[model samples]
Target: MRALLLSLLLGAAVLPALAAAPTDPPTPPVPSTTDGLIAQPWYRPHHLIGQVAGGQGMVTVGVGYTTLRGRLDVDVLTGYVPRKYSITPMGIFTGKATYSPWTLGLGASRWQVRPLSVGGLVNYTASRGMNASLDGKYPKGYYWWPARSRAGAFVGGRVAYELPTKANGQPRTASLYYELGTNDLYLVSLYSNIKALSVADILTLGIGVKVDL
Candidate 1:
């Protein structure tokens, strides 16, 4: 009887020790956060500026974010075009925000011969599906002789494709796109003034690099 009692005591001690052996609580699934949402290859912010073939220069800076569902991008741009024959300068500043497939943008600009102006842009992306965009702007300043307040409006469209890649086991992606558009200026003075400005139909192209954080 004593041996049996001792055996029972030993079993109890061993069972408790086994139960107390550190158990790895099931790893709580790693909490997901907005930080995770920003870890995509398209999430990093970037800055780009360059001069076109005609001596016109432009600068842009922006950030982008993407997830399994969709994406968002916002950017600011400033451009300058020197007068063809005079010492005056034409300048523009714009802020653009967009979602995949559709784009919306607004801008303010000035000219050596014109007043402060505001403008809007709208675009559609075709490669990603059926998407469309719309934008507008209003000028706050004056224009040169014979020209009224240089307020203007613009509309545009584009097609884009995102190519995904990997470098050293890290995610990387790039985008290719093309756009076309037209602009209208509200110059109240010039009797024969040209209000409609056609954006030279050109293939707007850009390449970007992204990193996951």
Candidate 2:
């Protein structure tokens, strides 16, 4: 009877410890937020594009980044233009940054719209006889801005048609964007000759597409 009582006591003592022991090890928490939507490295580019006009080129290929949940963007593009469009046949490079204050999502659809965007850009044109600054051929301060490089401001819109993703991964996405803008030289000309120039005459239009990576 003593041995039987001792066994019963031991069983009772172990019961609480067994109940407290975890059957499975603890797991690291899965993030419940939209962190997955961000790129692995913050500085990595998020998109690529092809564009026309905006003083970069008649046609250009570019890369871009999106931030603030797609509220802001920046892009760099490069391309070629014929002598007919410039003083000489040239290669052009451009950098642009923009902010869209609002994005309106279409109901239950994969469409997202950024109805307004404002931005600025700088463009460099490489020509055989051309440099950003004027050559000795021109007197000092004859021209207000540089000859081979131009800076401009723009306003625009973008409409994105998000593609459906398969069960395995991230959502596919693409967008169409267009902008109208003016350069420093154009503005100088406009204000200097207001009677001869209209806003339409000073503005340049750019149409492009962006593909998310």
Candidate 3:
């Protein structure tokens, strides 16, 4: 009887330990904040993009980096135009910096919209005999804007849908965007000849899709 009682006591002692033993695998840890999402490779780019117009070229493709929870974006794009379309087959390199201060969530549908985005860009187009120099070819200060380089500004909006990301805790998103922009030369012309050129005459439209990694 004493031996059976001792066995029962031992079983009771072991019961608590077994109850505390882990059964299912440990739950995946939740990232406490957005900064932790890219802490490992902080400098890695966040996206790849394809665009049209925007005063660079007929078609543009690029890579981009996003910060501030996808609010600030910087993109480097390379654009191309066919020889049949223009003077030559031109290659344009453009760098764009955009500020999206706000994002509006669309209910629980995993969709978001950026109502307003403001940005600026600079572009360099390369081609034979296409140069950015007055270089005494047309006398000094004859042209205020460079032939090869252009500076522009834009305002735009975007709609994005978020996708499930398991490998990296970061959100994956695909977005479509549109922008209305004008070049520095266009703006200068508008300011000097207000009645002659309306806002639509000076505006250029850009459309694109972006995929967040």
Candidate 4:
């Protein structure tokens, strides 16, 4: 009878040990959800705009993304002088694409002249929102502001710097830049009477903000 009791007690202890032995945690199946895919770092678009000094206004819109640990940016801009002019508007359209350490830009401007000016630029960015560029512009029409078509080519450079801040959980950025260019304006009907439309010295200052969509 004692042997029988001992055997039953040993069986009970062995049964509990077997029950406690760990089993492979039910293999957690890989997540199959949209949120899971988006949880990884990915590309997003950004933009900015601001006012020009002296009551004149300027605007810029652009898209950019980050990949391979580098940044890619592209932007277009337009500028206007308010109330001082009518009919023949003066403006510029600029498109630029930039990769880390190198940038390329193309621009067209109508300076109250019918000239369809086209230009290209090469630049380098030293830091966030800071860069220097060497650019060129060629005018095709008359410089009518002076009652003459000025056909010429201009070469210039610009330096730009920007600052960023946040308030109320929003991003605000501001920028200031200056440009200097020089080229000869060919007076229509007077080949010998040429004037220089000093493209080499202009300053642009602006402030802007960012929003997510």
lDDT per model vs. reference:
0.33, 0.82, 0.86, 0.32
Q: For candidate 3, which ten residues in a row score worst on lDDT?
A: 31-40
Instruction: Give stretches of model 2 more than 4 Å off.
Output: 1-37, 131-133, 137-142, 165-172
Which stretch of 10 consecutive residues in model 2 shows the poorest summed lDDT? 30-39
lDDT of 1 by residue, 115-158 (tens): 11122333211122212122122243333221211122322232
Order of candidate numbers by lDDT, starting with the best: 3, 2, 1, 4
Q: How do all models score by TM-score?
A: 0.35, 0.76, 0.80, 0.28
Candidate 3 residue 200 Cα shift, in angstroms, is 0.9
Which ranges in model 3 have alpha carbons more than 4 Å from their true place? 1-37, 40-43, 131-133
Comparing 1 with 4 on lDDT, the higher-scoring candidate is 1
Error of 2 at 90 (Å): 1.4
Report model 3's TM-score to 2 decimal places: 0.80
Give model 2's TM-score versus the native structure: 0.76
Q: 93-149 in candidate 3: lDDT tens per residue?
A: 999998888989999899999999999999988888565576677877887678888
User: Model 4, 66: alpha-carbon shift in Å?
Assistant: 5.4
Give the C-alpha miss distance for residue 145 in model 4, angstroms.
16
In candidate 3, how many Å is residue 144 off?
A: 2.6
For candidate 2, the lDDT comes to 0.82
| Candidate 3: residue pairs that collide | none
In candidate 4, stretches whose alpha carbon ends up further than 4 angstroms from where it belongs are 1-44, 51-70, 83-87, 98-213
